[model samples]
Target chain A: MPKVGMEPIRRAALVQATIDEIGASGSLDVTVSQIAKRAGMSSALAHHYFGGKEQIFLAAMRHTLAVYAAEVRGALGMADSPRTRIEAIVRAGFGTTNFRREVVSAWLNFYVLAQTSGEAGRLLNVYQRRLHANLLYNLRPLVGDKAEEVAQRIGGLIDGIYLREALGTKTTNGSKATAMVLAALDLELGQGK
Target chain B: MPKVGMEPIRRAALVQATIDEIGASGSLDVTVSQIAKRAGMSSALAHHYFGGKEQIFLAAMRHTLAVYAAEVRGALGMADSPRTRIEAIVRAGFGTTNFRREVVSAWLNFYVLAQTSGEAGRLLNVYQRRLHANLLYNLRPLVGDKAEEVAQRIGGLIDGIYLREALGTKTTNGSKATAMVLAALDLELGQGK
Candidate 1:
């Protein structure tokens, strides 16, 4: 029997293990047993907590999104102006915590998983919408009526940088990634003016 | 016994079938048998032709790259200036045939596969390198010393648009996608001046 208060710790362990396992394999082709082994728990215990691999993956996805959301929120809080807010959001995206190889790999695989899993797909949509809304809100003060379009480009560029990084085509350089995006933001803002 | 001229035709069919299957399922979690059935052939024939799913997938990736290369080549031949050449390349990325949902889906899965398969990774590298070279070649006359950075931004934008499209968050609007990338190009060129 498990002790009280152990469930949350075990679930967190399992979720982190899921991310690490997916990162190592570079895909969602991992089994519950592998994740369980990595978490240092029995497959049965992992199953008892998360039901199966899909649930475990979803939990991991949720955790990744939560971390990202917190980063964005923290950055936004520190931003004093609209343009600065935009910079903050872009910087948060390429921040060390979210831009690690393992996290990026998990993100790419999650995008793939969203195709077949309804829950995963819904979670992805939520993330996309929030990101878009955040950009749009900040962009309106800078780009005026073209805020939506400019927001889309910035968002796309951020996602694009992540995808490129995931392929290992370029070394994972967060500052470089941040510069590419900020340059795009600069161009968009300049054109809008 | 098989006919002598039938090999190329069968291989082409299998490649197309493979793209369709991945697109329909939205992942590389597909089986050779499913692809074979989709091609209206037996599993043994698919196995005999490609040996396994990975080869079939690699072949499909090759076909996608070939088609994209041909489109860019055809477009570049018609371009009369360096700036127009850049336009030609960007437009070719969002061209009607290449921008179809199935092809885009295949491209995304291929990125995932590249992480695990050496051949897939090599093919992807070749595509990325060629794209960068083509963009750098044209961007030189316009941006001078900044050509490489400009080219990287443009390439990343094109890819970013495709990644966004794959999630089905927005309709697969090639014209809109093309416009966003071209706008980025325009901004980059304007800045370089």
Candidate 2:
């Protein structure tokens, strides 16, 4: 007696569960049974929805990216100046919804998966490209001819912070991470002034 | 008959083989048998020497750090200024011995392993602390009191670049990575002028 739209709901739950499981395990060695149990469903049901562990993890990553895209769009929409736009984009990286331990662990695993999986690699490239484009757009007004270089530098900083936090070498909340990036931004953009 | 002094040579070979296996696998999902086979030894011998994959990987990491330490020391010994010293350390990151495909892959795996393994975490922290200390020492003369902040940013950039190259998101050689970091240094130090 499942509803017509219940499948989507269940899939979303399973994806979230997969992220949680990976985070709890601190690795990508999660099992379908563990994810299914976390989602309050049977392994058979989870497999029915996502096929296997890789599919579930892929869906989780897609969900992560989609949320990130929306967050960036929302942040940019509210920004009024170049500085604010840049800050908005940078802040979006450490947004509460995306910076949880579970999500961060999932991100680390995603990068590792990207090394060997074509689909994961493509997703990562898209994410990087969009981030680069967004930063360049915001930076062009501030740095003139140096926008590309500045954007790449800032992009690397953001990724570096994320990578460090994701790997547990650094423990920082959103504000601290945001401050570090903004400091770099200040050095780069402030110098131009 | 085995020689009495063959242990060190065998251990070094096993460490190199471990790096090779991890690089070829593109993940730490490699087996002890695979590593042993790469070293042209039996799994039992590898186990006898290192106990397990974790111990073997730790020995490999220690070896990587030793090489990096020597490179930085050598580069520093011949340096003429703080700028050159900073450049030397940055260049050391991409040095031929440290930036090879095998070594870089091992580095990436080390970061992932750090998230779940305390030993790995300690090793990473030591590396970070030493790098930070080194950068701050070199930056203090150029930027005065702002050296610490600047050093952290530069360290993050170096790590970000390494992560990108290791993950195949970006492919850059030693000179290119050095130039990118020097550009950041120029921005920070140039602004002070």
Candidate 3:
């Protein structure tokens, strides 16, 4: 007896609103009312969709991860070689859509929340495992037996760049961040010109 | 008429308590009274010493940085080569004293706080600049023109390891973290066997 498509649109609105609210506040001290207001919806609707702040936050994190996954997939799809695949994955990390200030702030909070929340922790683990596996998959063809180590080192470098960029301490761009990763790659694979 | 030397001890206690509280709570939701209680003092005494929670957190951060700086000094003192110096610096990051659960939590929150805090941001910049400069200094003799890039890469790797270990997602030891940096080093300087 209720609207079907409206739920997805409403849910999506709440999720984006959660990101904006957390980003604007730069902390997880956001309220359901605040997010609801940002989404141009009633608090009751927001609550009905997400249940609580933690749930709302969880949903937002899932949305962020999904977008990131899609970007990585798109990048991988365009690649024909291991090197290009690696580059694509690295580039996706700092791509325009993934590197925005609000999203980075959301990521910072997500990292903090994962420290205490089991659900957040599990979500983080899944993302990290997937990233590591993907890197290892492509790296194995290029580095052979050292693929695991190379993947970890590369993954660490990417994370380090992301964390620094997210903190806004060292100014960097997508190309700059990607360049660093490639430098590490060249070092590992003897690919430097 | 207050006891001489009491202020330093009291202030140090509050800062340590702040770290402990943040570590225990895994977030910045800690109250001033909680920190004061952990420090075995009244909230009024803590306020007298630090002005408020922000100042208290700032002091805690300054204390953490000071301790890190001291470790770097000690490590650099025992260094015999550029490689050793780099090794010492990397080891210092994952050293038991600095890599404690609480200190890392404080660091994660500090990163989050820096996003919106000019003071926090500046402090982080100073710390990062010093670290980068130190790495570059040791790396120049070994890698020449590429030292700047290599230093940035190594610095990023160390940070990545610390950030990962801090999140408690993947358990890594000091030597392991240091070895990863060294692996990157070998890749950079072609020193890998």
DockQ of each: 0.62, 0.56, 0.64
TM-score of each: 0.96, 0.94, 0.94
Please state the CAPRI-style docking class of candidate 1.
medium
Q: Residue B176 lDDT in model 3?
A: 79
Quantify all predictions' global Cα lDDT against the true fold.
0.90, 0.85, 0.87
Task: Please give, for residues A105-184, the per-residue lDDT of candidate 1 as tens digits.
Answer: 89999999988899999999999999999999998988799998888888888898899999988895999999888877
The most accurate candidate by TM-score is 1
Candidate achieving the largest DockQ: 3
Pairs that collide in candidate 2 are none
Question: Rank order by TM-score, top first?
Answer: 1, 3, 2
Q: Tell me the spans in candidate 1 whose CA falls farther than 4 Å from its real position.
A: A191-193, B1-4, B191-193
Q: List model 1 lDDT by residue over B100-192, tens digit each.
A: 887888899999999999999999999999999999999999989989888888888888889888888799589889888887787887842
Worst 10 residues of 2 chain A by lDDT: A184-193
2 against 3, candidate with superior DockQ: 3
Sort the candidates on lDDT, descending order.
Answer: 1, 3, 2
Q: What is the docking quality class of candidate 3? A: medium
Q: Which wins on lDDT, candidate 2 or candidate 3? A: 3
**Model with the higher lDDT, candidate 1 or 2:** 1
Worst 10 residues of 1 chain A by lDDT: A184-193
